[model samples]
Target: MPPKVQQKSKEQKMAAAMAGGKGKKKKWSKGKSRDKVDNKVLFSKEQFDRFHAEVPKMKLITVSAVVEKLKLNGGLARRALRDLEAEGKIKPVLISRSQRIYTRNVAEGDDE
Candidate 1:
């Protein structure tokens, strides 16, 4: 006679998946939104201008550049940049799978 295989409950299945079936927790941490910002309260005009002032002469700046210049975490800066882009204050020049390049909108003769 053949031996019968045991079936697992929902809880036990979840435990097994979480243990090693999913390829470890570190890989999933990158996709989590730990420092999300409220879109309703984003600063458009004033804050956008100030943020640009920090890097006026540059042709293009990455999200990480803004983060380092503004002393904000990478995720927070990325969120703020997205909000600014949606507001039409800045435009995305180039977008890669991992990073985005943004250009500030300034007057024709404006320098610095």
Candidate 2:
């Protein structure tokens, strides 16, 4: 006598899949929906100049503020802030794990 094996039905297979058969599904966070910026993308001289001009008026600047002001995405705003900092146009006032606040760098004679 031979023994017969039973095959799983589609419903059973789907249930198994939902019940931890695979790794967790990717979660959609608020920040995750923002477009990612390309590292190779650099700002134009004109754009940098505009930011530089406007930065002094802002006592405190953040990535979100830049995004709103320049109409840039989250990632691009972050990169722009970093670039400004690197160029000595802006100085970081506060640095946190997820966010940074910057203020315009005062020129040597500007304050006098």
Best by lDDT: 2
Error of 1 at 4 (Å): 52
lDDT of 2 by residue, 28-108 (tens): 766656575543235578766776688655778998887667656677778778887897777899999988999877673
Best by TM-score: 2
Worst 10 residues of 2 by lDDT: 34-43
Which residue pairs show backbone clashes in model 1? Answer: none
lDDT of each: 0.68, 0.75
Query: For every model shown, what is its TM-score relative to the native structure?
Result: 0.45, 0.52
Would you give me the overall lDDT of model 2? 0.75
Give the Cα error of residue 23 in candidate 2, in Å. Answer: 41
TM-score of 2: 0.52
